[model samples]
Target: MFPLVFLTVIALDQLTKHLVRGGMALGESIPAEGFLRLVHIQNTGAAFGILDDARPWLIAVSSIALVIIIWLAISRRIGFLDNIWGRLTLGFIAGGTLGNLIDRAYYGYVTDFLKAGIWPAFNIADASMVIGMTILVFLYLRSEYPRSQ
Candidate 1:
């Protein structure tokens, strides 16, 4: 399951990046209109543009993190990828992580193409990661709530 999810994400991420790289130029933005656009930007940093110039370190850290996450999902049997909610969340994150990891390993940066007003340009993988995390949080909260008193 993890492998399948990872592959799907990586395929989608690479395909999108390839299309954007072939069609758009650096710093160029294509308006999707209504607060959305496709822009080509290479990020050598982590989320929100942190550590913008630490490619090697970022790669190392991300790789390690990915391994740890996978291990936890498989070994500890965490709820982040076993049931429906877990599967969905893990699928998104696995895909996103591999997508960015591919960039770090091959291009020394992550290729970000999707953009929206006030939001950084990101790719499908990033979206998956964000959405996955959001779902995980929602599930956690739901589980914590007391049943009807």
Candidate 2:
């Protein structure tokens, strides 16, 4: 289950990035709707364009995350991947980390294309990470506290 979710997310991430890179020139935006667009740009840093020129740092940090994720996958500590939600959450993180890691190793940067007016440009990997993190937090909270009726 973990492998399936991880592979699916990675495949989707790679495919979307590939198509965006192939179809759009850097800094080009194709409006999809009201305030949404497909904007192609290579990001050499982390979210919100922080450390815009810090590819090395990004690579190192992501590498560490990958290692921890791998360890969790192997050890199954903290009941990691114990449930369907857990599998999906970790899958997103693993896939997102690997997606950016691949770009860092191969191109020295991650390609981001999705754009929503005021939001910074991002790709599927970023979305996956955000989604995974959200779910993880929710799961933890739900486990820790039962809702009072």
Candidate 3:
């Protein structure tokens, strides 16, 4: 399950980026009639283009995160990960991290295309990371909360 989710995330992320790059010119945007838009933009930094000048640092951080997540999943140090959902969450994080890391290594930037009004443009990798982390946090909180009779 972990491998399936991980590979699926990575494959979808890379494939979407590839399609966008091949079909759209850099900085080109197709505005939707509503809230969504597709824009070809390269982000040189982490989320929302922060640390634009620190590509190497970002790569290092991403690599470290990937390692830690992989370790946690394999080590079974966290009890929650004994469940399928927990493993899937970790897979999402690992796959997303790898997806962005690949882009930073090969292109010196992450290719972002999906855009919604007022939100910073983001790619599939970013979406996966956010979703995975959100679920992990929920799991943690749920475990820590005191259940009443």
> What lDDT does the true structure give each of the candidates?
0.81, 0.84, 0.90
Give lDDT for model 2: 0.84
Residue-level lDDT tens digits of model 2 in 120-144: 9898889989998998888877773
Off by over 4 Å in 1: 32-34, 79-81, 144-149
Worst 10-residue lDDT window, candidate 3? 140-149
lDDT string for model 1 (1-149, tens) is 65677678879889999999899999888774658888999998988899988988887887887887677667746543456667667777878887898898899889999888898889988988998789878776676333433
Clashes per prediction? 1, 0, 0
Q: What's the TM for model 3?
A: 0.93
The residue pairs found clashing in candidate 2 are none
Candidate 1 residue 66 C-alpha distance from true site, Å:
1.0
TM-score sort, best first = 3, 2, 1
Name the regions of candidate 2 deviating beyond 4 angstroms: 145-149
Steric clash pairs (candidate 3): none
Q: Pick the winner on lDDT between candidates 1 and 3.
A: 3
